[model samples]
Target: MSSATKYTRGHATFNVISKAILAGFATACLLPFILMIIGSFTDNTTVLVNGYSLFPEKWSLAAYELIFKYPKQVIDAYKVTIFVTTVGTAIALTITTISGYALSRPTFRSRNRIALYLYFPSLFGGGLIPWYIMMTQVLKLSDSIWALIIPSLVSTYNIFLVRNFIRTSVPLELFESAKIDGAGELRTFGQIILPLITPVTATVGLFIALGYWNDWFLSNLFITTSSKYSLQYYLYNMLNSSKALQELKAISGDISIEIDLPSETAKLAMAVVATGPIIMLYPFVQRYFVRGLVIGSVKG
Candidate 1:
């Protein structure tokens, strides 16, 4: 690395090279998603010809039409997903924020021990069979929406993020002032602490929301009812069924049907539909997320 003064040749060269490199890297990252969007509109034959291009020679909505054919089912799945993400995120944030704050406080007697205990799960976990038994048999959460909400209500990693944010960014003097002024723990947390940690709270809240929104494994493991399927799980089932039927048809040598199913494009279209809103959510929280990451990265 060269240490150069302002506007020198080396500095100017590095700046130009850095800008081009970043631009290319960003484009590389976005290329697949761009291709996916284009591919969703490209029919099977056109895809065969163009093979995932910046611009497709032909375009069609047959895939989207196929997907929306069961609009009621899709809508119901959307409602279930929306409800889960909203309710689960709210509850998760409350639990994670409160626990993180408590753990972050120097005055808390067992803060270090509790933080370690909370972090243990992220390193190691009980086996899947035992976890399943606990949820289904012990807790009686099988086939219930609570199964989705409760199991992932708080994450060890997220708690640590919150803890670090509070310990580093929030001043202890403020808490002492609140204590001297006769503010209870709950009141201090709600009114003063909550307002101060808005950046970190938003960051953690976004993480929880994304986790809830994209969850499908919990549905696969616990949920059996079609009516209760989240959007991701519903799409997973659709894609799996389509692939299974295609495989069965190939094995059976059945070529009798005249109508072609939008197999590949439909899968891509479903991906687009499921994740579209989440992509839109990133911009709203990006500033807070950057601040939280920076603050949380600092050691206490």
Candidate 2:
């Protein structure tokens, strides 16, 4: 055989092996989600009781029916989640971008000290009890929607992401040109810096939105009212409500309510529901993350 033929054969074998490894990694990441999604549709219950089955022996829509029975509650949860995700992401991006821009500027004498100040939050947030009391008693924010929105307004990590992107991406000459154009600091930021950082902003915005959408802990703590609960927390309580004595007794007691809730399935389905929009969003937003990082490459 010719040397070229031998080399080609070896390269083809390497590509096949590389593809196989990647497929395995992808499966590892995706299989759980697939199982969870399928389980939601399955008639199966717990791991102890019903083994993991993708398809069901007896197909049932009872889980969905029960979920829909409280349509208003579900809708309200969706509203709260949507509201929090939108508002929180917007506020966070603005704050993070502005902070990042200031930090990225070389002339800012106190930049290092400022960075240290912001970074301190990452290492030394007070205990949860103190933070909760500060929000609830002193601020009188318990059971309020502000309880959910206000605390999540900024993240130290996101600020760093924006700073990194801005430091590397935004050109100093552009800032100088804007100053020469008679643009004030706000104008320079609004017209120049923001437009250029679209990639990172979109990427970070999605991150912020997902964080708010998925969060249930804050709602559990400061929020006591059912109406004010975000979608994730609302679903959390509903998910556990399967074992609630009243729900069980009612399902059994009422002939009119012949609903057989596949509570386990509903939990899975609700998770799928809660995450569906986010999953759809990821592909589009993920495109931004790479392109943004590339656009923001640090120049020497």
Candidate 3:
């Protein structure tokens, strides 16, 4: 009968309702991935006949078997992708954070001009032909792993994200305090600024890693040797080859040659394979990612 007891009950009910809604929303988001994973295991014919389902009538490993038919190639592609993602993310985070910090500092007189130079490319590009010529003819990066790492080393958008995050989330007094302690730019950055911007750093690092991981365009353009192909590019080639085989079979109607290439299921399988590592990586940065985005986009 007490007023405080009624308020407590109301708050508890609100919490329960909120949690239930969030749980349902989370399940809705997760169902598609579950279906895709299950659908990949479903028989190709069954999928065509019944469509995707969480519980498929017939489950098969044909798609996975085909993907891993040559395990060595997949493994090599994984190695290349891992190397590129690791090295590229490190270098990218370094450059982006440094550039962002410099631009965020009010003492830097040329920051506005430098930022204009950085932002100009985001709005306009010099066309792909020139970029390709520069990469292949001038830089001589063709068929080299550096080709993959160098081109995507610094993202303008990422630099801006870091700059904004630092400008908004970090205080100018911290920089001054570090300077007062006789710390140089590098020392202040490493000792003070870096730790304070952990959320944005994780967020930017995740973005860079995902970009490097999912990149297939650079591989398709610069890489001639199959050995240097990234995982996504390798899987893309495999999927294309599967489609080609399907098309060939369709074209060669009366030949009576049996070809059992999983097309739809192969695509599902490739998605699963390519996204596995990224999915695993997401949970680690999920805590920082949302916070970083909010603070970084606060219009500081």
Writing each residue's lDDT as its tens digit, candidate 1 over 1-300 gives 546645878878999999999999999999988988988988867776657676878899988998898788788889989999899999999999999888988889999999888888778889789989999999999999999899889788788888888888788899999999999988988999999888788888887888899999999999999889999998898888777777777888786531444467787898899888978877886786687677667766
lDDT of each: 0.85, 0.77, 0.86
Cα lDDT of candidate 1 equals 0.85
- lDDT for each residue of candidate 2 in 1-300, tens digit (9 for 90 to 100): 455655676788997998999999999999989987777666644432667776556556655676688788778889988888888888888898888778777778998899899889789878788888899989999888888888877777667777787777677798889888899878887888888878778877776777799999989987887878888897788666655644667767854432443357777778778778878877777776676465445432
User: Candidate 2 at 86: error in angstroms?
Assistant: 0.7
Alpha-carbon RMSD to native, per candidate: 2.9, 4.9, 4.3
- Candidate 2 local lDDT, residue 92: 82
Better of 1 and 2 by lDDT: 1
In candidate 1, what residue range of length 10 has the lowest lDDT sum? 255-264
Task: Tell me the lDDT of model 2 at 204.
Answer: 77
**Which ten residues in a row are the worst by lDDT in model 2?**
254-263
Q: lDDT score, residue 293, model 2?
A: 60
Looking at model 3, residue 286 earns an lDDT score of 79
Q: Return the lDDT, model 3, position 220.
A: 96
List, residue by residue over 252-279, the lDDT tens digit for candidate 3: 7733433455458877987798888778
Q: For candidate 3, what is the TM-score?
A: 0.81
